[model samples]
Target: MKKYHFIAALLFCSILLQAQERYFLNSDTRLYTSTSTSAEFLGYFKYGAEVQLLSKNENGWYKVKADNLSEGYVPEKFVGTRLNAADIKTVDNENPVLAGGDQYYGGNHLFVLVAGLKARALPDKTSKIKEILFTGDPVPVNYLPKNQDEWVNIGGNFDYENAKFTLRKFIGKRPDFNTLIKEFDKLNPDAIAERKTVAERIVELAWNSDYSKLAPAYQRYSEVVKQLNDPKLIADTELNVSIAKGLDKHKLPEQIVAFTQKTEFILKGIKTKSLFLTQKELVKTFGKPAKTASIGDECGVYLSDLFYYYPDLEVSVDEKQNKAEIVKVFINENNKMILNANSVLDNTITEKAFIEKYGTYITASIKAPHSYSLQFEDSEFRIEFKDGKLFFIEIFFYC
Candidate 1:
């Protein structure tokens, strides 16, 4: 008889959850433009507000429509077919979920930002402490204040040992419970200790091998050292110092700094020297180019031809009859160039040093991950940086 009652209750719940039914927002819910948490937010629906359930997706997001004809998506866990009146709590106006009522309606998922935060029985700082929350701990939104305080009600009997902050329900993916906790446990003392042990093991291996001779071993060491110096883990100064000292004994080759002398490059000033030489002069100085390309109506009015050297140099030229005067120059890596006597414009220069030397640039654009192109106040000169170091440069001239 009890089994039959249980089955009947399940069927009743399913019927209530059918699409097109009137559903109530279980928590402060957000209507996103799409199913992703990272998508543009349309608006928020207050808790217990009625919404029309259009449908649900495989990822557990509900297609919902509000009374105002506004339609968007909300997470499956943030809505319900029926409301439990007992779940409602009194509103406090002093602290909001986020400051200044900026809290969205559907902020059902949140992660701990600080190291130690207290979970309370009520939405007040003076409320009874249920438990302590730690950094990176993912918590389900229980009740957000409709009044005005930052305090959140996490409910009673939160099982921290067996908590499952599954991403599928939250972020629509899997890291499993154990793995997710490990990721959240970044600041956990044991986890930090484990990382330190692994880093030390890598250092020991790098020390044993002839890093200078084996390129692969040296590359591995360089990667490990980079991670060891990561900002988040830099707090471990003793380990960092010890590992750095161990690796410094190797004394690998350093980048050769070129073009140390200062030379003024006045962008708006008169052109005293030309970056590009005439076709006749180019061949005379560097012999015949490795390749040549003709540019006409298809390219643009300005560029007539391009001359490429054996390696990292390209020269654009304008031709009339048998003579072609250089119009632009592009160079990459290992070049003799000076932005001013104080700053060396070369591949070996770091991005910080470049900016410090040049003051400010007009426009900056992302070329790729960790790569950027910066154009100064003068459009004729464009510089590109990759991996935080100078990558290439382009200088344009009409002559």
Candidate 2:
């Protein structure tokens, strides 16, 4: 008798909660078997497809039934009130499947102004997180809903609220801040010096341009400045620091390892057995690095990796393979590493001697304000000359 009463109560609630008004899918949306994003995916509903609204959960997932009697859950953001195809705005050449009709309607660019913004698999808050985006990250906008401004469909992923952002409608090329950040990361000398230069440039730009009105934008800008000013250092153990100090005192090997396609070579009295030396071997030879840093976004999806800094060398390790693949030797005031048999790195080697020894390179260009880089064809080695002398020598795995 109690079980029957419970079943009756559920039926009564379901009938009361059922939506009477019609609703349509605002974008190409996926249907989940359950309310959770981890549930089985039923299928996708085309843009502007009419769906029967069942019930909406507290977390904004809508229980809906498709025309074919396919009952599943779709994000509430995707379900809109009676959408008309003609009323939607669109641009040419956008994907028809992702947009309404043959056009995409939205700003030309979507600039993320906040840090740690999570990209969702669906527009709803309960959807699976695809990636974490940072400040200045330009999200690729594929389609924007005309009815609501709550969520945006970027490629396939979605960002919540769309509050901490700005949109631009220009067709011309714009300054890519993210690319500039990547270039700033690749700057020579050290992370501290590189960040100092970048931070100063950011301040100059911010001061010159019109400031954002949003409070969150101001907060994010402050955070970026703070991060650049106070760069995080790799927490090295005391024993590791001691080992690095001891390794620096030793006299480096005098042999010149030709900067060729060969992976195995002796560098600074330490021998590399393969394209990448294991962390164990690196620690044994050069000791653990003083600071470890990343070159790109924290998610590291595209052009991103880590660099471990020792006393006079920067070691870039491949995260996938867990080995030190790229080694950069910085020739400082003390002349840390000698290169090419007798060529010293302390701004004393002549250009004629460099050309006579290494021969002509495939390309030579100015890399920085006062630095020049030379790259050889069919080789993984690159040499940067500062003050008309060899400054930085880098070698990495070709692949």
TM-score per prediction, in order, is 0.31, 0.28
Candidate 2 lDDT by residue in tens digits, 110-206: 4444334566544345555766554443454433332233344444211123322212221112234545455555665345555554543432223
Q: What is the lDDT of residue 147 in candidate 2?
A: 22
Residue-by-residue lDDT tens digits, candidate 1, 1-399: 565455335334433554335577666666678998799765545565556676755498988754323467878876777879665533324222322122322333444443235664432345446565443344554323221222332331122222222211111111133333344345444454454443333333332323222233233334444555675334333333332333344322221112211222222121213343455554565567787776553535344554444345565655453344333333344354554445556557765555444422222211122232333222245566665666666554323
Ten residues in sequence with the least summed lDDT for candidate 2: 163-172
Shift in Å, residue 7, candidate 2: 71
**Segments of candidate 1 deviating more than 4 angstroms:** 1-272, 296-301, 321-334, 362-380, 385-389, 395-399
How many clashes show up per model? 16, 0
Error of 1 at 8 (Å): 44
lDDT for model 1: 0.43
Q: Spell out the clash pairs found in candidate 2.
A: none
Q: Specify the highest-TM-score model's number.
A: 1
Q: Which model scores highest in lDDT?
A: 2
